[model samples]
Target: MSMNVSEFVWKRLQEWGLHRVYGYPGDGVGGLDVALEKAQGSDGSGMEYVQVRHEEMAAFMASAHAKFAGGVGLCYATSGPGAIHLLNGLYDAKMDNQPVVAIVGQQARTALGAHYQQEVDLVSLFKDVASDYVAIGTVPSQVRHMVDRAVRIAQNKRSVTCIILPNDLQLMAYEDPPLVHGTTHTGVGFPAESKLPEQEGLQAAANVLNEGKKIAILVGAGCLHATDEVIAVADKLGAGIAKALLGKAAVPDDLPYVTGGLGLLGTKPSWDLMQDCDTLLMVGTSFPYSEFLPKPGTARGVQIDIKGDKLSLRYPTEVNLLGDSAVTLKALLPLLEQKTDTSWRNTIKSNVEDWWKVLEERAMHSAEPINPQRVFWELSPRLPENCIVTADSGSVANWYGRDLKFRRGMMGSLSGSLASLGAATPYAVAAKMAYPERVVIGTIGDGAMQMNGMNVMITISKYWKQWSNPHLIIMVLNNRDLNQVTWEERVQLGEGKTESTQSIPDFPYAKYAELIGLKGIFCNDPDKVGAAWDEALGADRPVILEFYTDPNVPPLPPHITLKDAKNFMTMIPDEPELGSVLKNSAKELLSTVLPGR
Candidate 1:
C-alpha cells in the first residue's frame, strides 16, 4: 500500500482509539492537517479535529483531558511558535504526572539548516517539558512505530511525550504494515492484584497504622479508584482523611473522617486533624506541602504510592509501600485493626461540622457588593453529583477549595502543577468533550477569565451541541482584582499597599458570551446571584454567568499565621472595605479558640 507518513500516523492514531485531537492549524503542517481532515471524513474513522483559537488552549484542553479521563491526551501544532505554545500546558501535564502526547508538524526535511521560515529545534525545545520521550519522524515507514512508542511511553510513564513530523515526511509514500503496541483503552487500572507490594511492606504499613493513635490519612488523586478501600482503612483505624487538591473527590466530603483538601485550599478540620495526628498514612499523592503535615517528629508516617520514589517525597516515612492505590489498600485493609476509642474520630467530625458552619457564616456575610464565597456555597448543593467542576487559580480557587464540596464521582482540576492562569474554561471544554452527558462547571476569576478563557469559550460554543448534554456552565467572577496574587503579595510584603496594578478592569464577560452566540447571565447585585446561577445551570447550551463580586473577600488559609493577621491588619486599614473580611475571619478564629459547644 502506498501511503504518506501523515496518513499512516492518522490511521494508527485512529486505531489507538483517539477520536479527538486538540490544536490550531498553522504553517508547515498543511499535509498533516489535510490527512487529519480526510481521516475524520472517512467511515469508522472515529476522529475529529478540535480546532482552537490558540495552540496553547489546545494543549491545555489535552492536558485536562488526560487528567480527567486517565488516557494519553493528544494535541497537535505546526512547527515554530505553534509548537512552542504547547510547552506550558505540556509542562502542566508533566509536573502533575498526567499522560499527554504532543504531535507537531515540522518544517520540510529539505529546509534543514536553511533557517527556513517557521523552523524550530522542536525536540530540544520540548526535552525539559516532554522529558518522557521526544522524537521526530524522518522515514515514512517509521511513522506507525513512532506513534506506538509515543503512546506507550506516555501511558507507562504518566508523562508528556512529543513526536515531530517534518512536512516532507508527512507527505511521503511508503509500503509498510503498522507496528502498533497499544489499543484504545484508559490503560492499567483496578482488579490487578499483581501490582500490590510485597507482604513485608504491606505488613510494615499495617503495623505502623495499627499501633498509632490519632492517625490521619492524606489522600491524593492516586486514591481516585480506591475510594471504597480508603474509606474502609479510615473506618477501621478511626483515622481522619485529608485530601490533596488533586484528590478532592477521593472520598466524599460528608464522610466523618474525610476532612476536605489540605494546604491553603484545605478546610479547618483537615488542618486540625493533620496538626494533631500522631501517625500519618500517606496514600497515592505527592502532596508537596510538607508544612501542612504534622510537626517534625510529631507524627510517624507510612506512604503508599505506585511510584516508589514518591513514597516519602513530602514527609518522612516509617514504611514505604509500592503498589496501585486500590490494590494496595485492599490488601492492607485486612491487616488493619479496628480502633476501640472513638474520641479522635469524634473530634475530627466535630471540627469538620464546625468548619462548615464557620464557612457558611463567612459565605453568607453581606458585602456592599456580593461575597464571592457565597457563589460557591450556593452552588455546592445544586451541583449535580455526577457533575465535573473545574476552577481556575486565584481567589476563585479559595472558594472552590473551601465551599465547593466535591461529592463522589466528580472529576476536574485547574493548573495544579504549572499553577498557571486561564485553564478552567479549557478544562471544562475538555470534560464536556470527553463526557458530554455530564454537567461541566468552571468557576474563574476575571483575571483568569480574560486571559485564555475567551478563546476557549468560543471553542465551547462551537462544539457544545455536537454531543449529548454538554451542560457547560462557565461562572466568571468579576471581582476586578488579581485577587489571589494580591492577597499573596500583602501576606508576603507585610507593609506594602496594593497598588492599582493589582486591580483588573471589570468586563461584562457574560455579555461577551451572549454576543458569541451563547447564553449569558450577568449579576452584580447581591440579591441576584442565585438567579444567575440557576439560569446558567438550567441552560441547555453553554452559559456564562458573570458575577460582580466583592474583591475584598479574602481566601483565609486553613490555619492562619501571625504574619497573615499582621498583613491583614496592615492592609485592612488602607482598604477599609476589606474590614468585613477580616471581621469574618476573626469570628472563625474566636470559634476555634473558644472551648466546648
Candidate 2:
C-alpha cells in the first residue's frame, strides 16, 4: 500500500520517540498538518502538533526539550520568514551543543529560482547554524537518509540539524510499507573510540599538572559529562576551582575550593584568584571575555578542551590538551601527585568568603524600590530544589549570574558574548520540557521579554498546558527601559543626555498574560514581589509576573577600578561626576571590607 511522503516522515518521527512538534501552521506545510492530524486522531500515541506564535519560539522550545529530555528536540516551520525566524534559536542550540532537529518546509521544488510566494533557499540559510543539512527530494531514499542522518548528527555532535522539505515533496506517493515499531527509541550513542584523544596529549597534560605549583582549575559547560572526574583531579592537585557562567552546575558551588565564576558580572575573589595563580588550568571551558583574564606576562596558562581550535582563541596558553573533559581528566589523574596544600586552599577560600560577606551585607541593607538585591533574595528561596534558571542578556543576566545562590545540583544557562535578547523565555520552555520533573524559571528584562514573550506564551499553552505540567514561570523586571545601554550612555554622556535615550514606553503585560490564559500579576510595591512570586509558583498553569520599576535604579557595580571609570567618564562631557560616583561608591564599599586575594 502506497502512502504520502508526509506519512512516512511522520512515522519516522514517531519511531524516534518525538511526541510533539512545534510551529505555526502555514499553507506551505499543509500536507504535514493533515498527516499530523491523521496520526494524532488515529494512533492516540500522545504525539501532538503545537501551534506557536513564532518559529523562533518553536526552535527555542525544541532546544529546551532536548536539553531536558536527553534526546533530539523537533521543530517545524514553513518556508521564507518562518524558516528565517528559526535562525537565532537554532544558533543558541548549536552554541550550547543541544540536539535539535528543525524540519523546514519549502516552496514547490520547481519554483526554486522563480521566487514563488514564501520561497527561500533554506540550504544556504541554515548552513552556518546547523551542523548538518539535508534536503529531502524523494520519499523513501531522500527522506530516509535525511531523517537518519539528521538524528545521528544531532545526537552525536550535540548540534542542530535542518531538513528542508519542498511542498511538492510532501504530497508525493510512496509505496514502501510503514516501518513502525512499538518500542521507544533513544538518540544515537557515542561514536567509537577512534575519535578519542591521543594518549601522548593526555600524558603531556599530566606532566604539566605534576610540575606546577599553586595551580587553579576553571571549568566550563564542556565539563558537564566528566564533572566527577574533574572534581577528583581538583582534589588530587589541591587546585582552587572556578567556573564560567555556563559551567555553573558542573560542580557544587559550596565545595571547599570552589570560588565563584570569572567574568564581568563574576565575583571579585574568583578574578583575584585567577589573576594571582602561577599556573591556570582550563577544563572544558572556552571563556571569551579577555578583560577578566590574566595578562600574558602574569601567569602561565594551560587549556584542555574537546575542540583543539578553541584552546588559545581568547588568551595565550602554555599547553593545549585536546580530549573529552571526563576522559582526559581520568587519564591525567593516575599520573598526578596528591599534593597537600591546605594552607593555599584556605587562603583562597577565606578570600571568597570575605567577598560573599560584602555582597550579602549590601543586599541586606538595600531598601531601594527596585532593589536588585531584594529581588534576588525573594526569588532565591522560592526556586525549586532541582530547578533550572535561564537568564537572557541585559541587567537580569548580571543579577542572576552574580547573586543567585546555586545549590549543589541546579543547572543554569546564560547568553555569553552573543548576548541576544528573547533567549530567557524559550530557554525556560526548553528546560522545563527537558526536565518535566523539575521546575524551570526564566528571568528576563522587560525589553528582552517583550521581544519573544508572545511566542513563548503560545508554546507553553500548546505543550506545557496540555501536559498539565505548569512548572514554567516568567519573571519580567519591567523597568520600562534598556537599562544596560542607559548605564553605558551615562558613562559616555551626562545624565541629561542619557535620560533622553533611556526612556521606554510601558506595555500592559498583565492584561496580555490574562488574555493568554496564564496567571498574571502586576507588582509595583517592592513588598508585593515576594507574594506575587509565591502565587506564580503555586499556580497550576504558566504565569507571568510583571514588576513595574524605576529605570534609573543603579545596577550592580562592575568589577573595574576607579581610575578606569574616571578615564571612561571623561569622554562624556555632560556626566563627568556620574562616573566618579560609581567608582567612589565601589571603592568605599571594597575598602571597608577585607580584600579577597
Off by over 4 Å in 1: 42-45, 175-194, 495-497, 569-597
lDDT by residue (1-597, candidate 2, tens digit) is: 567888877777777777777777677787887888877756556566767788888887787676556678889888889889888888878877778899988888888789688887788888888845555564444576577678777876778898888888888875443556632233323355433467777677777787777778889888766778878998888888888888877887667678777886677777877787877889888788777777776767778887766888777887787777887788778888888767767778887777666665555442335455556667876777888888888878777876677776788886554567888887787677566777788888888876777667766766775443676788888877786777665553434335555566688787788897887888877777788889888988778888776554445443666654664456456652355445544543554364431
- Tens digits of lDDT, candidate 1, 510-584: 789889999988887877777777888888778888888877666778778887777766765565345655665
Q: Estimate each model's TM-score.
A: 0.94, 0.88
Using lDDT as the measure, which candidate wins?
A: 1
**Reference-based lDDT, each prediction:** 0.82, 0.73
Query: For candidate 2, what is the TM-score?
Result: 0.88
